[model samples]
Target: MIWKLSLTGMKTRLRDYMILFSGLAIAAAIFYMFESLATNKEFLEHSNTVSVVGIVFHLGTVLLGIITFVYILYANSFLMTLRQKTYAMLMMLGARTSKIAQMIFIETFVAGIAATVVGMVVGVGLTALVNRLLVNQMGIVVSHYTPFNTAALLVTLIFFIAVFLIASMINASSIVKKSILQLLNEQKTPTRFKRNPFLLFIETIIGLLSLAIGYYFLAEIVKFQIMGLAIALVTIILGSYLIFHSVVIFVISLLKKSNAVVFKKLNNFTLSQLSFRVRDFTQILSMVSILFALALGALTVGLGFRNQIMTFTNTAATYDIVLNNAQKIDQQKIDTLDPTLNVTYDQKYDDTTIYYIKEQFDQHPFEQKDQSVFLSGEVNDKTLKYDAAKMEQDEQAQKALQDLELPEQKEKQIKLISQADFDTLGLDESQLQVINVTDFTTILPQIKTLIEENEKNNPSLGGAEGQNSFSQKYYVYNLYNTFFSGFEFMGFFLGIAFLTMLASCLMFKILSSANSDAIRYEMLRKIGTRQSLLKRAIFKEIGILFLLPGILGSIHVLFGLQMFKNFLSQPYHNIWIPFTIFIVLYALYYFATIWIYTSIVLPKEKRN
Candidate 1:
């Protein structure tokens, strides 16, 4: 009988269930997405840059889990509200308390199961879509990536089922705390407007002080490493909550004192509604702002890291191509391509030419790179000179050989050959090709193919297929692009997931209490207030709510990106991309909220 009643309740409140379902499905889909990426061992192992992609993704899992934990609480509270009246009616008719507990448990479990099924389907679709966009828009090639994973699917199911079961148990335990009358009176309660000026002032001061200290610590990031991150997280999160809770209301109260603005038609009502909504909505506002900051900061910093490849490569070397043992066909191919910059070196090595640069070749002095190598953190004005090496079999000489960047060849040692020995021993001739083009990226494929073909025929060149023909810029670009591309993929999806949850939370906070506003709007209509005027009030209220969080969030992003200053050349680069995305989506959600709010308060004919 309880199961039937629970199913009936679900059928009656399908709209509320849809809201609950969508949030759950989106949350589950994102969880599965995170798990799939985090668990892919082959993908992380192949990344060229210095990072533990697994640890990073696992950190992402923890962050998303925290967000989901909060979301489930909100979801459960909404569910309780939806069932309050039903529970009240049941109790008045003498339904057992144990029976009521059973009903709530059944309802929560059923909803979780339904959401999981729909969510897995959505998760698979999102994975494919995200992969396609990364490849098409970001120019990344993902290998051994499977959108559908049995392990991820199983983990997602178990996690959400556990969450739902826990929420149900918590709700079931609370059944004894409320009386029949209290449950029935839940919907009738007027919204509370609580204020404490002294407390508010103190909180505002503390929030400001904490934020200042956080910014100070952030400025000197190298000093504080892990401790700095901890202080910053705690202080900023606390400050944001307090700022929204107390400071925002204090400012709003000041605006209400202005007769010029308050006396305008329906302006007073709008301000009053905003003031009431904000008093209790501070934590929600703060969470939204923090989520926005994180999403935008991730995207901006990710772009900066991705672009670092191009920046490092461009300034690292002069010539676009460096070929060893240039053959007749190689020069023919190099000439046909028409390099704007060319330098040829003709030298005779005393021994094998591949392992060393002849000391006698210094007479014809070839230029070495003026910039630092990719893995090295600094650049020097030092030029490559083989004569500088001690040439002895001592520790210092071996150290000098190991540190030589002139060869730039992976794992190759250089020993200088004497001119007298070069003349004494009859050695083979070798040629080097240093060629530069207007653009290296566009013509890289052709160059790579040409090198591979040459290596296929002449084995003595001893160059790897992809490693041959080094263009300083193109070389670094090829090396680091894959890593940054993966980072960008993670950033893009994490941002989307956060923004989606944040938007849904804001929307639900407004819509769940929409029925309560109907009486207020009807009373206004009876008192000769225009429908247009009432709608303007709704628009003003929701718009201000949406804008407030976003404005605050953008402020956080401005300073938050400072933490990444050391990791990136320009921490704030390409920031507008994420900002534009946030603004557009937030605006649409705002409008949608207004439409729903107005529809509930005012009928179609009245609104028209």
Candidate 2:
């Protein structure tokens, strides 16, 4: 009998159930996606150069787990609300409370498992699609990464099943504890907007002060680092909440007292409705705003790093390739790049020391003063000294001589010899060639081939030696790939997950209250209020709700981006790209929420 009732109730509210199902599925899918990356040890090892990649993935897993848990609870609570009145009716018809609780548990558990199953399937698809997009967009080569993984599947299944079980129990218990009368009267319960002048004053002052401090800390993040981030996170979140709580109420109150605004059209009704719902709306708005900031900030930072990959590479080393004792094949490969500039230095090496002619260096200078610029000065004839203090003080000269080491050679003293002395040495001579190409990225394939050949010929210069050697083009290539595939990869997916979850939170929260709001709309309809006017009221009200958060969130992003300035040359570079994308998505959600809310409350027009 309980099974029959549960099925009937589900069929009756299939649309609402679909919303619940999709929300839960999205939560599950995002969790599964995160797990896919976290569980892929081989992929992490291959793609990331960061030492703490495991720790980063662990933190991400915990964060996503917490977010998914909270989302499931909220979604389940909405499910409970949708069926509460129906349960009350059954109890009044002589059904036992225990029976109803059993029915609720069965429905919740069944729906959860169904969503989780669908989510895992969708997760695989999303993993493939997102991975492809990242690879193409960022030019990263990820190996040993599969869209479907048994470990990820198992972890996702275990985590979501446990969450669903806990949620089902909580939902069933909450329903059973409430009396039938309370359940029936739940929608009709009145909500009030409270305003205490002294408290409001204090909150307003503190909120503004908190925001100021948070902004200051975020802007100066380089100096304070983690401590600054902690303070900023706390203060900004608190400030957002308090500011919304107090300021929104104050503004609505002012509008309520103004005859010019309140007496206009349906403005009075709108303000009254806002006043009643402001307390709840404030919390949602604040949360949504913060989530928006985080989502957009993540995407912006990720794209910033991606766009500046070449710039960062150039910063580390000026020349595309610097080869000691260039071979014929190497010169041939270098020629294929249509060399913009080719500078070679003549050198001779004896038993205890390597010598470079001073005149050769002066004639065609190839020393780097900075990351990109070449040094402009005459070379002095002196023995090269490896003084740590002197090298640290003269970073430009240190960087210029960074590629002094050669394969299978003992550490030897380097000296600048006169042309006459260099010619008289009779030691074996070699040429160190520095090649520059018009575009570094255009010749990456050839560069890789050349590097592999070099490493093969000189087995002593493999792995760490090749990777850390600034003179090797392979270093730039590897660094570029690692940066995009590591932190940037994580950032992009995190943004997408947060954006989906938070938008659903706002949509579900609004829709959950639709039934409670239905009676008021019906009352307005009976009193000759046109459906058109009602929609306009909804547009105004919901539009305000969307607008407030968007404005605040954008402001947060503008300030929050300052924190990345130390890491990035220009953190705000290409920021509008993410902002534009977010605005379009957010606007779509805004309109979709209104349509869903309107469908629940308004009557359909009759045909002639």
The models' CA-based lDDT, in order, is 0.69, 0.74
The number of the candidate with the highest lDDT is 2
lDDT of candidate 2 over 400-505, digit per residue (tens): 5645446544355557767898889878877767777898787777876776676665566654445336566557556565555555766776677677767777
TM-score of 1: 0.84
Give candidate 1 misplaced runs (Cα > 4 Å).
38-59, 132-146, 174-176, 184-198, 218-222, 315-319, 336-340, 352-425, 454-475
TM-score of each: 0.84, 0.87
Per-residue lDDT for 122-222 in model 1, tens only? 98888667656644443335676778878878888888888888888888777646998888786666555557889889999998888877776776677
RMSD of 2: 5.0
Best by TM-score: 2
